[model samples]
Target: MSDPILRLSGVFTDIAQYHILQGVDFEVPRGQVTMLLGRNGVGKTTTLRTIMGHWRARAGQIVLDGQDIAGLPTPAISRMGVGYVPENMGIFSDLTIEENMILAASSGPIDRARLDWLFSVFPPLQTFWKGQAGNLSGGQKQMLSIARAMVEERRLYLIDEPTKGLAPAIVSTMAGALRQLKDQGASILLVEQNFSVARALGDSAVVMDDGRVVWAGAMAELANDASLQERLMGLSMEAGH
Candidate 1:
């Protein structure tokens, strides 16, 4: 396998004197989806924030495409081909959808083909191109957030809980869009609480426990091991919850 597009080695993040991430280590391979899964308060979101430089790491290295990015500012880290979609879906509520996209467009020529592809994948975005982002539903806002990230053609995306708080139909839509992005050769590091969504999109799974990777392997192995799910994810595969 090729070297990872993003790598976190022995990463430790501290908020004042309190430590959030302790020796977190993981890798996101190119053109693949790596799902980070764990229960709430297990440092999943913090890991993403740390990677994006929102939460600075006090120890270890954050390498993007083999270059250290640990000390870089958030904007500089983003410019190094890491796009982030936080759990809040960070849409510019007051701006029109088109305006939001325009703002996110990097300092390069707009990729019309990519824009058209995104529109095709997210049809609602096309219909609401002129609508204010605040007016869109939860799922539409998530689509816009992902679209905003795609506008700059980043090499890797850190998406936090893309399916959270969405209708089942909308979750399906978002899943389809992610699949399309993967097909188009984008590497993704996804944080998801929903096992079904993770199982569907993830090529590999990293199970976090108390800010550390406790398990890492193919998603299929995770799907087949009910005991592991019960122990690591606090989930039971008993037909229907």
Candidate 2:
């Protein structure tokens, strides 16, 4: 197997007085999606934040492309070619979709070719290009958030619950966009509550509980065994059947 683009070894994170993310370890392989799965409050979101440097890891290492990034600031981490989409869909409400795209183009001006590709994947972005982002529907806003992250080329994407609160049809669209991203050779570490989305997109799976990794294996193995799925994630893939 290829080396992981991102790896966390014994990572610990703290939020104010609360201690979250205790010794988490996982690997996101190059050019594939790794599903980070668990129930609510299992430190899934915290782990993503810690990787992005929004929350500091008090102990352990966050290695990206063979370099330790645990001590780096958020901007430095981002500059290292990591794109993050927080669970809150971090788009500027007052800005136009075009402006948001421009702001996210940290490397330089938005490439017209890349912009056209993104619009093809998400046609709503083109339809609402001149409109204020706040006026977009929830699904369109989610598309914009993911699109913002795509304005520039990045080695890895850390996405938190892209399917959260989205309608079934919209979730289907988001899943297709993610697959297209993978096909274009992007590595992704995804946190998703919806088992169907996770099962469909993940090449590997990591299960976390109480801030620690509890299971790691192939997505197919996890999906094939309902008992194992229940033990690790408290649900079966049967819902997707």
Candidate 3:
């Protein structure tokens, strides 16, 4: 209802000659989770990349807090208060957990209070604080990636497929952490495939099909409408259970 923290209007992305996003329009409300859902290969990931300036938009405007960010470089965008967590978790294999955190640390005195809060939210991070990131399990890697993002206190986060290959138990843990982040007033645009996980984390849903947004509404509405889920998400309500 109010001005969104991130707004994508008529966003069109082209990878060389191939167009990925076609006239995609969506708004990510501040301090709320917005789930981006679609069948595989529908450009959900591309949308996240485009937003982060990894892939420049050939047309459209990406506005963040009333400023145009579409034309900015990726590093510029990151400095503009956006954090990104890629699907691979983006943990440096050779670096220790602390080293990875230091890499994401912006040019300022470390916020001990935020670090303590992050460690409190993720205890494993405290235990493996000295361990190499590659040595940590998949779930732990995810926690580190998220913690790295938190260290900077960004205004918005673009998380891409965070639960893609995680175990069921780990997925549950990640979902819980996401809920905690949302409760803490983090504006998140989550690219997710697991319907249950998305339902648990999201306040709103934006369903994309063939690189275009076909549905946008409250998550509960899409969760309850089995027909819409089946038609747009190719998911059966029975399958979710």
Q: Pick the candidate with the highest lDDT.
A: 2
- What is the clash count of model 2? 0
**lDDT tens string, model 2, 104-209?**
9998899999999999989999999999999999999999999988888898999999989999999999999999898898999999988899988999999999
Q: What is the C-alpha RMSD of each candidate to the true structure, in Å?
A: 1.5, 1.1, 1.4
Q: What is the C-alpha lDDT profile of model 1 across 1-241, one tens digit per residue?
A: 5798988899999988888899998888898999998888889999999989899899999989889999899999887788899999888999999998988886766688988998998898899999999999878999999889888778899999998888889888889988988887889999987678888889998999898989988887887788988999798533322
Sum up the clashes in candidate 3. Answer: 0
Scanning candidate 1 in windows of ten residues, the lowest lDDT window is 232-241
> Which ranges of candidate 2 are over 4 A from the true structure?
none
lDDT, model 1, position 16: 88
lDDT of 2: 0.92
Model 3 / residue 122 / CA error / Å = 2.1
Backbone clash total for model 1 is 0
User: How are the candidates ranked when ordered by TM-score, highest leading?
Assistant: 2, 3, 1
